[model samples]
Target: MTFTPTLSLYVARGFLLTTLLMLCALTGLVALFDFIELLRRAASRPSVGFDIPATIAALRLPFVAMQILPFAILLGGITAFWRLTRSSELIVARAAGVSAWGFLTGPGLVALLLGAIAVTGVSPLSSAMLARAERMDQSFLRTGGGMSSLAGGRLWLRQADRELDENGVAIVAGRPTAARPADPRDGFARFELKDVTVWRLSAGDSPLARIEAPRAQLTPGTWVLEEAVSFGADRMPTRPQRIELPTELTPGRIEDSFASPETLGFWSLPGFIEVLEQAGFSAVRHRIQFHSLLATPILALAMALLAAGFSMRHNRRGGVAQMIAGGVAAGFALFVVDRISAEFGEAGSLPVILAAWVPTVAGLLLALSLLLHLEDG
Candidate 1:
């Protein structure tokens, strides 16, 4: 490589390394604070284990790195450009027939490569780890492992009897937890509930029969309600009775309720969207997230362009201090625009793809305009 290309490559590599180091340091400090808080909360809870705190800390690093990437890119690019100007390396390259655009190619290529890695590789890993971390947090924090969508927590279904077309059953209970208990035939697939109430619905949806119980456990195809009270269809109170509920709901089905589409990676978003539609839930947020992931590279490139446009002027024309100030101002302005666009996108006022990409495109255009003015003028 020529001196210009070599210098640009060196500067770009240095910037990448510096940005990654700064991001890791800042994220590590924040993670330490978060871990301390998590540990304190775990200490307060009697049954909660220390494993959750460790898991949370482990998951936070990747998330923080993702969040800080744009800022790091901007700052690192500015630092590199500032150093080149200070050393008069850019001037030397220009004297040797290197155009401003020519010098930028190396760093731009680096940005593109980094952006690709972030979207395809880092994002999936982060999403998976974050999902696991969320589950751990919930299990350690909530009761009954939280409610599932399809089954487990007080399921109510109306079934018709053979003789009369009456309402079937209304089930309510405390502690309707789902777990895979040991079963002979099915091996291991069941949903169990404790402290259950089953109400048989009569004509006009009136409660015809009510069964109160201390425990009800669901097996592969059956629910066993124990220590229950039975009421007659005549709306009269009967003596205590126990019964079995015939149903197909299982623990896996219940767990599916808590599995959100956002927990999936970018690669899984399309399939997840199909599943969401089949399940009757909207996938708007997931679609937006996927688009945002695709836009990450463009956003990083825009930040670098903005930094260079604002900071990489010749010192003879503008002092180094002024250039640095201008760069900082430009970065902050871009950040504000990005935030506004994100809010608009989130509120559905703007198209998701447009909102995610507009700021980046705007920044790149602005930078190109400035570069043309500086170089050709």
Candidate 2:
């Protein structure tokens, strides 16, 4: 009954195990459902083999697990605390003058630590896999990638072409500028750009030509630019009524290249945000995502507190179910609020900091209030 280090470690160990179990269960179930959904989508495309959907679903699991982590913490905390109470371990601890907060400190810290690890370690892998999954989904499952991004009323895309030199050395033009290495599997597709500017580069990154157009539309395999003008290093600018350029970009690929903030790793976000803003695109969503990730540890602590509030008590008839239901409802309420505030922040209706931290703050306050009421009253 003593609140010794061994006792606290035991409690924390139990909580971590349960949380890991819950995460695995939830992630596996979700992945199974996702695989089925992908299979259904693949049904229409006879050429898409079974492996395509399976691979995509597997690649998507990490992102899904990230999204489900908070829920796993809530459920796991509830189970762990409920077990302690049901087994009279917490009851004996209370009889020994150890308050609820004393034992909960271990699990709360564990949750907080796990959240930090997820944000810093797991996020990068999840983002990369999510990006790859999106590309696969676009290429294999869908006819088009998706709607192209018009961030801050501008879009930036880079295209590359390769040629063999006389000595058989390969030269690349318009090299990729993304943080990650370009995937060799991506194929060329038609693309359209607005307020488009094309830079033609040669070996050693030397500029060859520059083309600017107000509007460009995709044809079968080319971009047709209207009111086009060209500039070269040694020649004066020439305006053309219309110009055609070959491309290997599709709307979907363009959208994939300009990935959403969620698909960029946490460490990569700041740089990508800077790139977006420098390219005349809004970084509001990326800013919101970054701040939200920073808030995850606090959010995890709140969930643990809330779970302890509901589940750490003397067992009463029919009370366990009620506490479980209430904890679940409260957890989901926090999630809904977080999503809503995020949307508001992205829409500029709320400050990014406020939107990102409000849910965590509110959850912590509410959980603390509940714990105080149960403990002191």
Candidate 3:
């Protein structure tokens, strides 16, 4: 028998309320612990107010929500279904001709709708806030002030090489100053590099000149090299020229490099990947994240099936404890597989789409098998 619109609405609302409450409680607990840790770290630094800490905590809420949403759906669906079973509601519905799949449609639809919202709406906000929070935390708490002399990360800069007839050049520094410049072009920023590699590509084509420097310092739109050697198109180092590499490049331009995939939001991953490819950077991680974001609905549905398949058996069987244990184990195993697949995708050993969707597909198949065996065998 098909449920009426009113009854479906009621079931959906009930499931949504239970899920939201569970998610809120879990997210709040995690956020509180995270905030306390941030506070403790902040205490060791200068007197920065609660703004950064609060912002970091607030920004982290959506990520926490996203992370716990599947578990919440699993637990809440199981709890709701278990209660219905224990109270004989499911039995009554089944006796009235409602099939298991029919009864599950309401909650499954709710999970799908919520998953869409979480991916499209919540993800961008969470990503933006996370970026801001990291910048603030790094600027105020970790750096102890504003920008430092020595920073550890990849730095990229574009310069002009008049001697090589190269108008625009790219330089990669192994380690550079974390110092924030008042102006993007101000070259007074100082950095000590262990190994510096400069790529001088043609104005519109291949590499024309390459340089390696033991160390370098920025001096107002120019880089001064110490113990530097230059390589030409023939792959031979010319006589060491104490030359001034003239360019409009600045410390700010060098420090604006983007690498970490986490900084890009789900909504922006596609565009960002396009930009990355055009700029000659690998977009594997972004591809994985994008596919993973698109698979969220399937993941949520799998979670629901996993929970219901295990927990919705008749109480007369006395397997509720076993069902709960199995559900938890399945969820954790799926998580581990997902992480391993993600690693493989990042390492280019697996296709991004396959890596992202494999766990969801596996969970769905397993849950469906279990459900069919229990309900129809």
Question: Which prediction has the highest TM-score against the true structure?
Answer: 3
Tens digit of per-residue lDDT, candidate 3, span 232-270: 878988676554455454443333224345556786788
lDDT of 1 by residue, 1-377 (tens): 24366767776786677667766776788788889988987887888787779888798678667767777777788877887877898788878877778778777777777777888888888778877777787778554545643354444433332122333444344465546656777586656666676655545666566677777876665667877777676656666566776654455544433465345677877776665443334556666777877888887787777667766777888687887788778877877987798778878888978877777788788878888887886
How far residue 37's Cα lies from its native spot in candidate 3, in Å, is 1.8
Consecutive 10-residue window with the lowest summed lDDT within model 2: 164-173
Q: Which run of 10 residues does model 3 get worst, by summed lDDT?
A: 250-259
Relative to the unseen true structure, what is the C-alpha lDDT of residue 123 in candidate 2, on a scale of 0 to 100? 94
- Which model scores highest in lDDT? 2
Candidates 1 and 2 compared by TM-score, better number = 2
Local accuracy by lDDT, each model: 0.70, 0.78, 0.74
Clashes of 3: 1
Against the true structure, what is each candidate's TM-score?
Answer: 0.69, 0.76, 0.76
lDDT by residue for model 2 over 1-377, one digit each (tens)?
23567678888999999999999999999999999999999999999999999999999988898889889999999999899989999888887888777787799889999899989999999998998998799878877434432344444554443332111211111212222333356643434455667776654566677777776775554667789888878757896769776555444434533677778888988876665553335788889989988988899899888988888766665587888899999999999999999999989999999999999999999999999998886
Per model, how many backbone clashes are there? 0, 3, 1
Off by over 4 Å in 2: 1-3, 146-257
lDDT of 3: 0.74
Task: Please identify which of the two predictions, 2 or 3, would achieve the higher TM-score against the true structure.
Answer: 3
